[model samples]
Target: MDLHVSRDFLRGGRSLLPRQWFEPMLLAVTAGALTAGGLSWLIGAHDVADLCWILGTVIAVVPSAIWVLSALRHGHAGVDLIAILALGGTLAVREYLAGALIAVMLASGRTLEAAAQRRASHDIRALLEHAPRSARLRKGDRIREVPLSEVAIGDSVVVGPGEIIPVDGRVTGPPALLDESVLTGESQQVERAEGERVRSGVVNAGGAFEVQATATEKDSTYAEIVRLARHVSAGSAPVVRLADRYAAWFLPLSVATAGLAWAASGSAVRAVAVLVVATPCPLLLAAPVAIVSGLSRASRYGVVISGGGALESLGHVRTLLLDKTDTLTCGRPRVLDVIAAPGQEPAEILRLAASLDQLSPHVLARALVDAAHARGLDLSMPSNVTKEPGLGVAGTVANQHLTVGRHNHGSPSPAWACAADNRAMLDSAAVVWLTVDGHLAGAVLLRDPLRKDAPRTLRRLRSAGIRRLVMLTGDREEPAREIATVLGIDDVHSNLTPADKVAAVHNESAGAVTVMVGDGVNDAPALAAADVGVAMGARGSTASSEAADIVLTTDRVDRLADAVTIAVRSRRIAAQSALSGMFMSLAAMAAALLGLLPPAPGALLQEASTS
Candidate 1:
């Protein structure tokens, strides 16, 4: 088949060269060869047995030879080279039975390899199939179904319950409960209020909501993931280097040994024996099997590693640089403490701030409302509430003029600057000033708490051979140090822009393999600059996930430790299997050179060593 035909089959058509086809054909040929050999030994029909064996060998070797030629044309020095040489040498020596047996072994090895590759790559295909193809576009007042390609930016789309979002957009209706489990491996339903951005592929779990499309389907988050998966899969995995380098060394060694045996013994049979024993089957099979097994294990833990190269790099990461916001903290700020005016109660100030913030769409506003509800405080909607995006909210609460926002730049009012405790809280926490009738009333301190598992996760990472753990963030020094000290991370770089973060990762990578963990659009460049970039997928920006080599499907940063452990274990297992196989093959080759092995027996020994 042509390359295009093969690709089409792999994508979504009938298999062009499926294992089923090769497996059954090889089995039938093997059975025929065995029957012919047994009948000839019983009735003395040697010519008939030779003919059946030769025919079976041709049947099995032709397809493999074509595949080898195709691979050579594509500039790939595949492992099939060794199998081709072994089969050709047996035929030249007139060892028909040995040729047939070697053919069966080659076919069985290839079938197993194909099965393992399919198992390892199941997630990529599943991701491709899960993307939505059609969208419900809102034209005027009526909604109509249209193919994703026809949906344009600025078109309004209606996402109903149980349907996947077709494009990136902003919620225009009431708060919608969305199941973003497909994009981020978290199973929780996220509530998206008006003006909040929603990505494609999330399932709308609540009632229908109208979304103003911000990006076309092709540029959506789900489509980018598909493109990234395809690009990564097309590149060769790291273990291919082990197999290629091994073949480069073993091929010439095997040929030279066989040639020397022939010249020494003046017997062609001895040379054929050497070739049979040094087939390199183990090098072809063991490394791939181990890698695929590791990938399967990682999938079970909700980490989608693109390839063996990425996994291998993750295992060797020595310096880990983390973005503080969503990577370490929860990325959501909560009301921690409230300092009211001398005569006013803290509860009264919080009540008024929460009540005014109810009309605001800022993330901190939601935290305030939730905190107020948890404290059993009753809140009422404030009249004349006004919200300025970057500034804060203002309204009339209990017939008193009130404002909640940053303090005026010129000078801090005596109510805040006079208290040492208030200054300390302002230094470490996000402080929002409250004013009543143009006088400073109080301040609300908000803190983005570190993730529950951040400390334990850092400890485990250090144990996994990470020499240096650094925090790189745009936050101020005090808050950054607060998180680093709690996590026992010694290195902290604060007030870093996205460019500074990239430079930090690049510089750290010069000393050792560095890993960058982040989850925001601003973190994309730094993520790409590291040796391996790990994206916290749950609640992470699409840009970050697209740039990251390894994506943790869940929000749990602790899974990074688990991923490192899996990668190390996989690499160790693959190395062990490959090295052990090579040693066994070399020992068998020594026996063959000493005239202790014949063609038939040598083939059996090679197969056993590989197994």
Candidate 2:
């Protein structure tokens, strides 16, 4: 079952006595009782020791009784029921010291568990606290500081160097260099030119630049991230369910044993011993501790796990489905090959194509420009540049008309024939034809290369017990197949829309736990549908990150494998701690049932087992 904290629960006011206050109060009472009982015993004042223990037990029992009543009112049974009975049994037998000790154990275990949960929620708190709160509003030639809430859409804002972008906006001035690490978890600085969209929470790494706000602070990407985080934090972890399952069997056994002991020995003392020894402390403590430790390890490696349930699910994932672009490949297209026309130089053809592409905003245009710059080729701006949405771009460079786009469907001449043959060789590469003065000049082959560590990471995932590996991508069949072949993935689903991806994940998840890793806006639906959604947070779209159960803060794909390994190790450790404690408790319970152990010694044994 999907377990989540309802909105009403968060909106509901805190308890009358907060855990912070209650824990300290309970601890102080326990300490006082222990001190008084020891001093009174030394002086041979048995009545004073009994009174001190009774006072501590009363102070502790108040909260325990309240919790049990609350649980019963909600029509549910709680693990605290056993502890409450143990306290009552000890008091009925006049074993005040044993009751006081059991009270201390229960209070201390609850406090520690609560503290671990608070620690695990640090990432969510950090996300909320780090949001930008102000912006510099631009009024013609003057800039005025204003609260982010007052910043509206269409308002011009001037972001200064090292300042966070207060809202999502379009850059209006010179190209701005921004560090988007805070927003996207990418450490690299990205360059945004005029008319390019810039998200909130990214720091301005270069000179001050003007931007026209497209969204208000409350409606910005950072706000969306904060909302998603809150939702994730409210969700319950699977480990909690695992503990409850253990308790389902354990509680009945403990109660039955206590009743059997009472009937056999005809003494309430034997029953009290059984109850004291079977308090379920290990189930209450060990699982959360292991989960918190795993979270700490993930943070050190730049992975932000949303909750303990996500970590547990990731550890047992049987099928792994991943997006192709930006996940397995670099997601950045680059010039791989340049085939020149007969007697035409490759550099000349590239120079012409890059010059014409400078006026377009298409991804291919940026790839061409970057390629030209890397070659140190100086290019002049094209004149009368025009781009047709699905066709190609056209312009005039140095008094010669040029066009770059798909190959025209017609009989190919000798000059175009050579380029066609080169294109045939690269089925996986994106081909852009270069035409100069109405003649086919050459073809530029662009490809988004596979990540260097992808193959090794895939192998490691197999070693970690991921039985099935699949690729689900919106890219064409050729590139998708090419990437799958390189990575040794057995399954490939290409050219799928967002809905198709969701359907794919749902189908896979029906049979086994499925993990979907992606980094784009289109991947959000599929991410949510998977059993465990892992987002490459660095340079990923906000939609995907918000939808993901785990966010890899770094761009390294290998970290995914490492996270799974850590999760598996953590699960094993938690099981070991809990089972070992239970084993010891069972042994102690058997001794207590036979009259070899008394209530006080049984409580001590229970404490030792849990510790």
Candidate 3:
């Protein structure tokens, strides 16, 4: 589990050791030197104290000098140049105590930044540990345990109860109850029937079942998620330093001011005082502290931000693009309404239909059965059952003939159920017609309803400064528009392919920072294309999670707003801290120039003002 630190610390090639080790090592050496120097000064061993302080100053200046030279080579002038000058200048003037203090402070700030990066990388690497390593390969009646890497497409894998599914495949036998909370964040156990697709990372919660694999281990869903997670950890970049922008001008200004002070006073000690006070400690430390704090806060709410750059961008998102299914809606179809014909009871119609559907494995059939059970309706077992795929199911329930499904050819025209059909169309629902004794009786309308908290989440997003909300979905225009109207979204782009979604994001991003939220394989490309891609990772496709810049670990969509709120607050606090710290440093520098402060006192005052 090697976690690489950001390139900023590693770019100079000055340190051969791993970047993670650099900060702690520097801190240890500086602390030892500081402690030894203070003890010698207390014992009146002034020469020994000066020697200790010189070691600390030299230790700190070497690496910072390397960093400054590296930046110069790249044509980048960073604020770190100020700290190097302060350390060297103080030592050159024989202000041993001041040089020692500056060295310790510089090392302390670097350690804090390094710790934050390690925490984030640790969080992402956990995904890799939980991935399955092997699968039960079934050849005819015999099953053998084999490494997951050896499994290939079309192989039959036997999954035991309570075991994790190893690859993407379809159920081959009786229905299997699976717990997909690790993938989707939903705690419910879903039953996948024969021929129904099941993804990796799901647990078999019920009886053991067999699956005919459709993808190899390398190409499986969970594998892709692991690959993405690894990439995030290895490629983690340093947050753009808000302080570095000030460094471009501040560095030269500090150097010139120090030169003038020395020329006027005819004392190098006076010049050292100016440089000591001008060090930009706040700019180097405050920005990373604030951003890392924001990342930690977001993680507590089940939102994982990639790095500092993503967090900063999230704080400023002006337009949000949403995917329709599994993002705004539950992605699971449920019975919403049941309309019965004249002289018929809606409950009785549903009871009869559910009774026949109990033996079927269709997704809609399960929805009807669940709905009936929710209403506390007792259903009798159907006899002489017959099924017509994509059409309907017919059987005898309570001695009365019943048929439940879509209307079929040569069936009596549903003249009396025209209102039910119209209602289904308007609501963008799937209608399952119920017929009894050859007469159309009632229709049960099912649709993927909005998540319980979706409306509230949208309201929060609006309050969080999202100026525009647009929905991009592959669903038909009618259904998409219907959902948009319900959600109060002003823009709707329907029937979009993966490429189309990317184009839509690019177009919106031209004017404002756009956030794209999605939860399926088709959403992967668009997720990568957006300014900030948020994946509904709990119970969603792992591909989207892999491509996303931010992932909601829980199933709640409202966390997105929570993350944005944290980002904005963190960035604001960072700006305030950096600007105010610099202001105080400027005032101290003025005092140094006027000779009211010497090098040792100036360094102490600089630290006090920034603190």
Candidate 4:
């Protein structure tokens, strides 16, 4: 609970100022009058034939009944109205305190509802305030602070030590290292050379590096996540058609049954008794309270579910369609394994690749560095380096012409075609062709590893009632199928464009609620198309967070199961609360119909019980 909401509770629930204060004081006064009337014969305070009790009762109870009806009715009658009519008319017959107490109880229920609602709104405000407002802008030899909106593409920016990069920029100069965990989830500070991309909102952890801007302000990934927060503020919920139908029937049935009891008994007291227990305040407050509590639990696990409706709908979701990149894997191309041409030592081939790649930022270059580090080799400095984009780098190590790159991205180093028998070994790694002293040496292969938690998360979702798990991606069939198999996913769709992804989301959602998870521009449309859109918060800076229904802050597939569990719990709580209130109301109606009580005394008993 927020401090501001607590203050409001003090002012509204305790003090009840302005018009609210008047009603409570008025009701208490009426209660006093009823007590006097009930004890009139003993007190001897009034003359015989006096009508003080009847007059006071009419004055106090009639308006209380009307106001109570107005508070609960939304253009239609409800069980609460029965309590009002029963007490108001009977109060005219000299029972005043009964009506007053009921009014007070009704107000108390409303106060509780108002405070809970404010607390939820305050939580959202606190979350949005965490986003940064200003960024450090860099222009050649001139460093200035500016609003994030002023940043533009193609401008060079200096990301200094201890400062956050404010816009997406491509590295134009080498640095010792950069901490990109905020954007890429890589544990180590990604050592940067030239021509590598860096996103805004990432912390600089090493020596200062100059980078040319690629995207800025609204176009940056951080800006997009903030936008996603805004869209999910209201939360997705169930269609109101069913709730409307329930409301229509409950009120009429309650009213008709109360009328019949009064007509059969020929006593206004029976009708009053029925009305005493008719109010649905308890049920009305129950559902929202449960939903809010459940949402708090979800926040602990890094999933921010927007509102009561979203939680309720999750109880019934059946199928799940997921986006592959960034959702299941690291989303960065890294070295997975290494292979050497026939008769070549794998260790020698990797050392040569790392030596030449020390100066590059191409996909293959990072893979070589990763491979060397895994083998406990230090990828320090080498001499006479000539690096080029779309071509390999040239360098001398041990008097050898060492080059590392793609036949396309890396310069064509001495080409060593693997003997036919050894070619099969290259398939497991993303082979980066390498050469040394103009002689074919070997190739280094790279791959983005699957998320450490993907398998476990998928299993939990299945246990939690998610029937089908589908993986959709722009990656080729083999990689997509490989990931699906690893994660125990049911269906795999590969080589999809953004438009095709949206179509797939709709297809999977047929007759079931679909949740689509992704972290790139290509996944935005599908996120919007699914019944529930979940963004992997850490890497989702690139995706349209605005389209997602829930944002997974920890950015893990495992949290999906946790999110579903929370939603189901919330719905269950709401249902239990609503039903409990309804059942209590019915019990009151049954007591009233038995002709054991009158409206005035019944209202007082019900009000006292509630308070």
Candidate topping TM-score = 2
Question: C-alpha displacement of 493 in model 1, angstroms?
Answer: 2.4
Candidate 3 wrong stretches, greater than 4 Å: 1-16, 72-75, 153-165, 168-199, 202-215, 233-238, 296-304, 333-447, 497-500, 520-525, 538-547, 606-611
Q: Clashes in model 1: which pairs?
A: 185-553
- TM-score for each of the candidates: 0.74, 0.76, 0.73, 0.65
Give lDDT tens digits, candidate 3, residues 183-282: 5546788999886778787889999999988668866667766665554531222334466566656778788888989899998888888888887664
Please provide, for model 2 over 111-156, each residue's C-alpha lDDT reduced to its tens digit, 9 standing for 90 to 100.
Answer: 6665666676666677668788888897878889998899986799
The alpha-carbon deviation from the true structure for residue 340 of candidate 4, after best TM-score superposition, in angstroms, is 20
What C-alpha root-mean-square deviation, in Å, does candidate 3 show against the real structure?
Answer: 9.4
- Determine which window of 10 residues in candidate 4 has minimal summed lDDT: 1-10
Residue 348 alpha-carbon offset, candidate 3, angstroms:
29
Deviation in Å, model 4, residue 179 alpha carbon: 12
Whole-model lDDT for model 4 versus the true structure?
A: 0.62
| Order of candidate numbers by lDDT, starting with the best | 3, 2, 1, 4
lDDT of 1 by residue, 121-140 (tens): 77767777888999998878
Ranking of all predicted structures according to TM-score, beginning with the best and ending with the worst: 2, 1, 3, 4
Candidate 3 matches the true fold with a TM-score of 0.73
